[model samples]
Target: MVKRQAQHIQVDLQRQQLRLLSGDACIASYAISSARNGAGESRGSECTPRGLHSIRLKIGDGLPENSVFIGRRPTGEIYTPALAAADPGRDWILTRILWLSGLEPGRNRGGSVDSLRRFIYIHGTPDSEPMGQAASHGCIRMRNRELIELFERVRVGTVVEIRERC
Candidate 1:
């Protein structure tokens, strides 16, 4: 029997935390900022979808820390406090991206609820942004360094379980 990949990554929404696990043991923990609109399963809801998902794509290989991305492509810009002050309304996707694909059928997979279609990702944010709170439009937001570390550790198909509570 194959031990499922689901146990490797866990997101506790209630705590605004993400864990990197080895079997039942946690290898690392990172504070996260989830959807400010809370949890839901709909495209354009601006809320995090709760379910089993896989890291469908891991982007930003060989990029510098705080490298900026838009539309999943590097924009030839590195994030800086000055740049942020210039474009205060910009929803920054920095460092790396772990684009997610939902595993559940109707809940988060197909139709309007599809996470991939929704462009849901676990990506990095500017360090100035607050962590350990619900703040993002939809994506799971992490600090750049932590996200870089996680991006290095996990594979493309690693399963992630996002939960509403512990």
Candidate 2:
């Protein structure tokens, strides 16, 4: 019999990568899109907040890939190229979401620095969106299929550390 170490997530803002690690080994690595504004903790900064966080909620289980979400709820709309063309400026949140809450107070948590209040999430982006670079408004974005796979592996309350490097 084998015992598997519990998995945790790490987001490297500088590399624009996200790694799923179990113990000292990396179980999976994926290209990610972080924030265009870089790293910060203030509300409306549109920057990725850096600190210890956890998956406060896991959303979109059983939902189809490319399923659209707004305010953390399914919008009954599946993303399509035509749909994207119709509203090109829309901030797309698709497939799955891992809502994050900061563990460190006065940094990523509480008041203006509250990541949860900022609606920081690890969610899916359109296939047309480029990864491996910082482009998100604030959240961590991944490919739809990749996000779904990650969502299946991680549970609510999984530790997720976001930093300049993993």
TM-score winner: 1
Could you give candidate 1's per-residue lDDT for residues 1-166 as a string of tens digits? 2245744789999999999998888999999999999999999899999988999999998899999998999999999999999998788999999999999999899999999999999999998889999999999999999998898999988988899996
Instruction: Give per-residue CA lDDT, model 2, range 1-166, as digits (tens).
Output: 2233377888899889999999878999999999999999999999999988989999999999999998999999999999999998887999999999998999998999999999999999999999998998999999999999999999888888888976
TM per candidate: 0.96, 0.95
Residue 134 in candidate 1, Cα distance off native in Å: 0.2
Overlapping backbone residue pairs in candidate 1 total: 0
Question: CA lDDT of each candidate?
Answer: 0.92, 0.92
Ten-residue segment with the worst summed lDDT in candidate 1?
1-10
Candidate 1, pairs of clashing residues: none
